[model samples]
Structure formats: C-alpha cells, structure tokens
Target: MIVNRRGWMGLGAALGLPVLGSHAAAAAAPRQGQMVHHVFFWLKEPGRAGDREKLIAGLKTLRAIPEIRELRVGVPAPTEQRSVVDSSYHVSELMVFDTVADQARYQDHPVHKRFVETCGDLWARVVVYDSIDV
Candidate 1:
C-alpha cells in the first residue's frame, strides 16, 4: 500500500493513463523541494453543466494568486472503468508551488477566498491531496 513516486507512475502507465512526465506541463512539474496541491470537487448537482462551468470559472480565477507557479484544471478522464479509478468528482485542479510557504500563502490569498465564497455551494464535497517530492 505504500507506493512511491515511481510506483504510481508505473501504475498509471500500465493503466494506459497519461503519466506525469508526459504532460504538456511537464516543464512546470514540481521540483524536489516544491509542493503540489491537488483538489477534487464533487458537485451538489453532479451532472449539471451550468454548475460545473461556474465552478471551473471560479477555479480559474485563483490563477491570479502570485504564489501559484502553475495551475491546471480538469475533469475526470475517460479512462477504463476500474475500482481504483475515482471519477466521481465533477472537477479537479492541480497546482504547483515553488515551496510549502508559497502554497500556504495561496490558501489565504484574497482571490482564493473570493473563489470559495462564489463557488463553494456548487460542490457537495471537496477533497485535497497535498504532496511534496520524495
């Protein structure tokens, strides 16, 4: 159950999913001391396109926060159906920060605060996974 970075990358490859380094944003990938903030949002009205777009729009607004080095917004991929694949979330975002301190500042940034106030109700649940390089 304790998979390291390489293990996860291998699993993704085996599953025919896009591996980390293959992304167009690979140049912006987190370095050894950087941090990644990954977040998933499950909408209250799961399949509502209107709500989804509104939330995504709000998420885009957070890019104005200075501490974010790179930000990518996405929806679940149309990968093969498998128990390990979690496609329940309506939207997801992956943000890379130069450091943990930068990421922390992003949390309190006014743009982020405004995003929550504007789109918080769209999601019934939100989950986040913050990781640093091993």
Candidate 2:
C-alpha cells in the first residue's frame, strides 16, 4: 500500500523486470483507501525527441479524467545505482483513484482513449500493475 517506483523496481530487479505497479494515493500517503495504477513503458526509440514529446503530452491528457485522485508521469530518475533500480523503462505513469470503480472509469475515459490512439504506437512494450487499497 505504500510502495514507490523504487520499491517496485527493486522487486523487479530481484526477479529481473521493471515492476513487480500503482495504488490510489491519499493526501498524505498511499493508505487512505485509494487504488493504484502504475505503468512502465519501453519505447521504440527512447532518444527520439518526437516520441518523448508525444508520449509526454499524451500522458497529460489522462489528468483530465475526473476519476483520478492523484497522478504523476515522469521519466526514470538518475538515481544512485542498485540492482532494484531498473531504469530500462522510458517513462513511468503512476495514478491513484478513490476506488476501483474510479480507476475503471478512468480506463474508459475518452481522453485516455485519445491518448492511446495518438501515441500507442510509440512504445514497443508496456507493463501495468494495479492495486486496491485494502
């Protein structure tokens, strides 16, 4: 319920992957009864400016969905190295919703649909992990 990307990646690294995933965040932490939607993307070309820009802009569109309680999209950090810090992903998207129903609504939201249509081709692979606050 309180895992960050670093923690997730650490698990993945131990098993060998980029994630082992999102939870709905509270105003303070992840434990105020929220769901998490976490995504990791491996791009076709991470160095391409056009791809990065398109993906970044597309991710912003998800914020428009009213169901999202919290959202954060960003490139991997240049963090101090450890086996768990898998930096292979081009970008990571983390979101928290008030409930599973809200996350489900976000899945079908029109803005989300548009983002996939516009930029889905840019990524070679995507990994998603979702969790419910229990």
Per model, state how many residue pairs clash: 0, 5
Which lDDT values do the candidates have, in the order given?
0.91, 0.85
Model 2: residues with Cα > 4 Å off, grouped in runs: 1-27
TM-score of 1: 0.77
- For TM-score, the strongest prediction is 1
TM-score of each: 0.77, 0.75
Q: Give the per-residue lDDT of model 2 (tens digit) for 9-79.
A: 88778987644233223334666568999999999988777898789889988889999878899998989
Candidate 1 lDDT score at position 86: 88
